[model samples]
Target: MPVTELTTDAEALTMTLIADVDAPVERLWRAFTDPRQLERFWGPPGWPATFTEFDFTVGGRARYHMTSPKGELSRGAWEFVRIDEPQSFEVLDTFVEADGTVFEGFPAMRMAYSFEPTETGSRLRNVTYFASHEALEQAVEMGAVEGSQLAMGQLDAVLHDLREYAQGKGTRTELLDDQHVRITRLIDGPQELVWRAHTEPALLEKWMLGPDGWRMSACEVDAVAGGRYRYAWEPLDPAAGTAFGFDGEVVLIEPIRRMVTTEHMTDTDYPSTLNDLSLYEEDGATLVTLLVEYPDRETRDAVLATGMTDGMEASYARLEGVLVSLPG
Candidate 1:
């Protein structure tokens, strides 16, 4: 119902469909990029598509098949031509056989998708260009317009489920004991990138800062065990004049797996704490668990009262963007 318009130009040999999705640009983009998400709404109503192979990069290929209620299989493939993050992408779409061969005499269309941000959500424009008027007419006769409309109509439900799943993965904090607290999150990226964000000084500065108007002034990391590390943050706004920092020593380092360290807040009265961070890969995502142990219950409670968990959650949210920007 949200599909705003569908148009065709026989002279230009193109078909265009525009839809406004009630989801952010990032969520809508993920629906097109993530293979699991793509499969859910790739075909028309009652004709669910199963993607056998999906690689969403420039020059990559995707192979899939849709099965109708009568048990007929419609195999299809796409060769990615260009991809521009959350903006647009172009691909060569073609009908194919089960053995990965293109269907003889079938028209191969060049498809382009553009996502634009609007006040309500994202506006998606899809255009398919045919080789000639004959090809365009052939596709139209095959119900391309109806099939595409049905597929795009299903995207709303997929986006809703993805949003709910993301909310469930938000930072979870638990009081393990009087002197220990554990914070865990299911991050979007892989373990390798998550580990790098934690151990690398440059990446660490991006999300380690506590709040707005604060900047990590200095960051140094010697990742090996027994190596020293220090980080300092200052208020960027001159009026909010305050500086605070922390220094630590790595007690253990396991690349892409775990790290243990001793940390002390330089400008606070709180006692030093031991931090144990563990990373695990689950279903292509990284789960990060951080345990902090203070010297005593009073110190732990004091730190908790400072709303540290809120800052951690905010910083972790920013880290998600950093992970998305990283090269694959």
Candidate 2:
């Protein structure tokens, strides 16, 4: 029902599929970037796919195999050409062997995927172009149309489970641009609970430690526009003998929906940074996206090289446990 249209153009030697998904653009985009998520709905009905190799960057290659109910397997590969975040991307798709050998006898196709935000949710468009009319005809004869329809139809159910699983797992982080980085996670429980975990000092102290054996020894929060907050962490093993922290002011606040804050380190010479956090409710789960901006690309790269992303991931994993223990 979510698949609104599937059309083939003989003149252009292409097949286009349009689907209206119930999930947000970011969530749908994750289904494409995350190989494990893509494996779930990549094949038609009874034929499930397994990705043996996946590298989502531009010019990277992804190899996968689909297993039919009769135990037959179909192997393919995609050479990524362009990746435009949550909006669109293009790839060269071709049949391949398990060892990554291309099947030259089969026609290779170019595929483009676009995601557009709609009032209800998101509209996904996929177009596959062939080398010639004969190639297109061959694809159609090989059940490409039916297989695509069945595969796209599985997206709704896959998205439902993905959102549910993300509630406590699968937090992801990526570089958005030269000076911006984005981290996203689905928090279990409602938006208000996630908001408290982010803004309340006591809850923050429980999960915001940067590394193992480090504990937040002091935390103070004034959760309001123009309010100030401070957090200090010390090694749990007192013998480590080092303490570090950050203090900042809340620049903007929108209750449980959004917060913007400035952060200045107390233990380092790193330049101050701004963080914008936004929360959205999706089927009773809270999707949190944190965008961090730096003054310049050099500073951003320097901080990233310090393994901040790994620290954030560690902290987020702890946050999930804390969320699980909280009252829903």
Instruction: Please report the candidate that would top TM-score against the real structure.
Output: 2
lDDT: worst 10-residue window of model 1: 160-169
Q: Model 2, 13: alpha-carbon shift in Å? A: 28
Q: Please provide, for model 1 over 1-328, each residue's C-alpha lDDT reduced to its tens digit, 9 standing for 90 to 100.
A: 4689999998888999999988899988999988877876787654567799988889999999986533468999999999999899999999998899999988789999999999999999999999998899889899899878867876765677433434456787767557767677778888899999998988998888877778999999999878999998899896896787888888776687767788998767667888878775655677676778789999888888988888888888889889898875
Candidate 2 segments whose C-alpha is farther than 4 A from its true place: 1-169, 238-241, 267-269
Residue-by-residue lDDT tens digits, candidate 2, 1-328: 4789999999988999999988899988998878877876797644567898888899999999986433468999999999999899999999987678988788789999999999988999999999999899899999998778767865764677638645545556666557667677776568888899998887998899977989998899999878999999899898986888898888777688777788899767778888878776767777777778788999888888887877887887788789888888
List candidate 1 segments past 4 Å from native.
Answer: 162-328
Count of clashes in candidate 2: 0
Q: Model 2 residue 45 lDDT?
A: 47
Estimate the TM-score of every prediction: 0.50, 0.51
